[model samples]
Target: MRLKFQFGSFITFIGFILSSLIVTLDLEAQTHQFKLIDEETNRPIPDANFFYGNEQGISSESGDITINFQPTITLTISHLQYGKRSFTAEELDQALKKHQLALQPKSHNLQPVTFISIHPNAGEQEQMTLQVQDKLAHDAGQVLEQFSSISSIRKSGAYGFDPVLRGFKYDQINLVIDGSQCATAACPNRMDPASSQVPLNMIVEAEVMKGPYSLRYGNAFGGTINFKSADPSFTDKANLNGRMGTSFETNGEISRSEALLGITSKHADIKLFGSLSTGNDYTDGDGVKIPANFYRSNIGGKIGLKLNSTQTMSLQVSNNYGKDVDFPALPMDLRKDDTWLINLGHKAVFYRGALSSWSTTMYATKVDHLMDNADKELNPRMVDANTSAKTNNAGGRTELRFDFDDDWLYAGTDMRIENADGTRKRNMLMGPMAGKTLTDNVWQDARIRKNGLFAEYHSQGDNFHLVFSGRLELNHAEAQNPDAGFAANYTDMSSDIVSPALSIGGTRTVTDNFSIGLWLGSAQRSGSLAERYINYFPIGLDPYEMIGNPELKPETNNQADLIFNYKSDATDLNLNLFSSFLNNHISSEIRKDLSPKMATAPGVRQFVNVDKAKIMGFEASWKQIINRKIQQVAELAYTHGQNTTSDEALPEIPPMEFRYRLIGSFINKKLRTELNFRHAFEQNRIAKSYGETKTPAFNVLDIKASYLIVQNLNVAASLQNIFDEAYYEHLSRSVRNAESRPIYSPGRSFYFSLSYRF
Candidate 1:
């Protein structure tokens, strides 16, 4: 069913609000938009500082800003390379009429590595401005892992590189796309995670927050990562534009290609995009072929309509498909997977100055997956095994913001409903039950629904900035059909839970070039469908069949962070020290009293609460612009996690790691070269109880170069794993082979790309 039909009353009320905006007046007299660009190159400049009236804000990617329109007002803008400039009322009026503004360059070259921006959110730590030549990856997770130190990926096979952050993965880390969270994985082994399902070619920007210091984006227990797409824009003149790109890799004989087309008029715009990727198994550093082969295709489009000067509406639709994917880490391989998504959005600036603006987004998505061991050498009793699963999700969020000079108040409501079902067929060719087929319920008609209300307040002063937010949620979960014996073990097959979350953060300027900040937060995360409804399935990091616990309580994370920052004309540096304490942490314990249901797995484990858990970490980042020709970005991060109740180390904590990137510009900024290096320290703190092993240290180097051949055409090339180093991440899962060792990294590989835009 459509999300609108599922949320009948809610959609009706929001629609009424949308209609009522016509009569409402924006008393603030705001609505002027400006795009800041380089005076010499005419390219957009990010992280520019602008001040007007009582508001001082930083420009986002491409230096786009919207402010109150006042003929008598004066605006001041400043940048590291562009220096400072002031625009008088007359100049502002002229710039507004022409719809073009530029700042003079103070140096011969322009370089930007990392900086802070105000909108989007206050807690944003980093932003990756994606480009066609830079983001040549098969999935979104690969694109994210290169952007920040706080982000990592748990590689499963050729397809699923699920995102991990701050020692948390899966449901603990919330990943959203254009304000909607709807990725639902169907495989118990997570062969196709949320990051893999979202079309990577559609993303224009990626941003991340370090911790759960905000409540406006759902129950973010660990942190939040938001993937943003190009907003459909209306131009005064009719325009038709598009971009196409193709890439090739020597290793695994990989090939990838994507294309985008857009048409815009005075009041409407539409965009279409598509991509295809195919690859075979690649040899590792040891000259051994890994089980990594896959084929994927994606198609998507977006539409936008400008109702008036104060209102805009958008709609998006997408489909993704995968086939013949191999997963060496798991017992089953992905035969086929398909996903469909539809999203609707509306925004309006109120009249009469009663409300600054209000926006709403509603989306529906579904994933259908099938996995089996058809290629594997079948065991005697378990000749063949096949499981089919699917997940359906529908959700919406609406927010109303009121601006008051240097402060703003925001109130919003969000809701999500999900349904899951799956069945596994086991074919017997030997043993006592030869030539007989057995059917087992993996997820017997499970459902999870949640409704939430949230509020946020922001205040800014000459030397300090403060942000406060809170959220209240009501969650419901149930299982309609469960195995008879499993049902009898846990009588309560349903639960209704109430969860609350809040956070407060403030930053103080201590001196001319130094600042300090502190953040404290607490969040609650409810159990997932598998955590509460799975039957006898080997779904955990261990090799034990797991049973569900319908009566599981919500987990909580109480966290604090101490931040130090320093900024200068040529460099920006930041350091963060953080700790998290958890209560009611969900864990698995062997259920000796129960008998095994899956023949290959003899042990049975049940989900339970671990009384206490903790994770502590620190991160340091540095960005330096050297002489406007060479810029460098570096990061160092470390994390330690433990099950405090059991006095043991956590299972999947990553080791200390460091990364560095150096960029050099030549030929009037048309040719760019970058060198990348990474080092990971050895990890000896293993969770022996979970059969975890130690990992050795390793280092890798890479180099890339891109050149603009013409006005709108570019060529790029890169060599990865330059040393052909054989290594594996500490968080890598053990493969299904008898050796039980993690998969090795790929050997030296070369890639090339050519792209054009008009």
Candidate 2:
């Protein structure tokens, strides 16, 4: 009896042990871990929010998180102002084993969330985007000029305004309207493009990305500007919104009026935006007439469809007509520029087990334009010398992202195609002989296509973070011209090019209030068709018709930057230093022996692979809240560049500048007022590459006042260039042999606006 009892006890003990082991295995399968890191610096972020099961969870003090999953588990990670991310059990396991997982921060705009997220800076160091309400409720140029990075603003003599960013001019910068590429053929002289299509009153917001970081938009060697129109907000309870405003400026003799109407439902939304502006020549600071006068009209429409919870599509079209646009810098002016643009895009998101989340978009655009000489000097001689040009572009980009738990990693690929065509006709009076007529036309009927693939990886630990990213791009270009005369002038060309880029950055946090970040990157750009095949008349730089250079090579640049940030509840300060080295910089230079009128003369201004160039700059900005009713934002920037081989100052470099803004609000924020001051140091180090023109320095002041009329209505007014100081941008191109040639900015202007929300 004793032996039998002992046997039964042993069997029971073994069974218990087996069951315990099986339960432990099941719990291990349900467990997961994650680490949160800063996007730019790749440093660990402590106390972030991590969610699993159906409820939100908290990260540990060391930026680490572990979760015991429930059945049908889903894991989500989120931080303040950063975009939220989530993953399924299968996706989490794959990401952890690969040791690569990352979540992108939210974009500046909250609506139409984007997957290609950039991290947010702490405190005042963060880049801020003006909301639609802010834009529609303020003066366009006045609001844009508030950013310290922008150095110059020129009213296009017509109704619109031209903004020169950093130092880049003309087509070197890319412009997008409603997320679609707007094509403009009006830049034959590199004067006006799609950026001029939208009046300030019609724009809901404009986002400018400085430097080569703009490659994602197009072949934007310098930068990219994106103009967004107001869309129906999902957060609004009502389905309709309407707004109207009017303003008059004394300096430019300008009168502007605009209106916007929008309708929204749960699934479908439509909007109509339009503006009308007219102005006459205005007097300068000294009461001298500047010959800056013109009239313009613009209209745009947008239609959007929300197909489902994760998919949306939109279509937009716009038209702009301008007459007698004048330019102080050029001898002959823009007589007429009629532009039209059409764009369409669709965005969607999908979730697939291990693949996680992905967002994709497809877009296309078309543009047409016509231009004529409008200067008083040319009108007396030529009567009419007009030119017309057109461009058509079609492209699409797709990006895929995968997130993991161990180390953050993201990868994507992009592709694009563009085509352009241009023509010019000359009508010369020739001493009343009914004017001799000459016509020249050029066509780029072929396609230029580009394909790129890229990947980025990030790792976050307790004290430090690291990131690595690389991209490879391939380009195929072909040009076809049907006009024999134009074809002979510009030889048919075809080429295949490849470019590669890499970036590495890291960050470390020494304490709770201080942190440092370092970044190094290299990028390359292939020449554009305009740079390689354009052979046309350049009105601004006379005694010379310009021709293209087919032998030009690609341009490359290497850059490094460092940033330090300090933060507190009431005050924030940031400092950054950066440097870049460019190789084979492609710039136009005159041929020494060519005569002034060889149809391609004034010495051929061909694009050449010039010597090396270097640029270095530093930027510092601070924001402080003096009290509950008062705050201040101040910024200072200095930049310098040189052409190493020529030992000459580089053309189109931003001068030293400073900006300050003071804000005061009262009556429980019902009333707000802001004061702005800006100063730019004289740019004496002028380059003689094109001409011996020197730009002077100046200072200006502005003020804005706003009053909330009701819960949905607001009234605001602004005064720009308050001091009416006379100034000219250093980068403005001058007409050859013109004594008074600098592009004069508007002297002083005042604007009043009213906004109403549904």
Best by TM-score: 1
Candidate 1 residue 308 Cα shift, in angstroms, is 0.5
Q: Alpha-carbon error at 605 in model 1, in Å? A: 2.0
For candidate 1, write residues 581-670 as lDDT tens digits: 999998888888887766677588898889999999888889899977799999998889999999999878888899999988877777
- Give lDDT: candidate 1, residue 553: 85
Error of 1 at 82 (Å): 13
User: How accurate locally, in lDDT, is each candidate?
Assistant: 0.76, 0.57
In order of listing, the candidates' clash counts read 7, 8
Best candidate, lDDT-wise?
Answer: 1
Error of 2 at 214 (Å): 7.0
lDDT score, candidate 2, position 457? 70
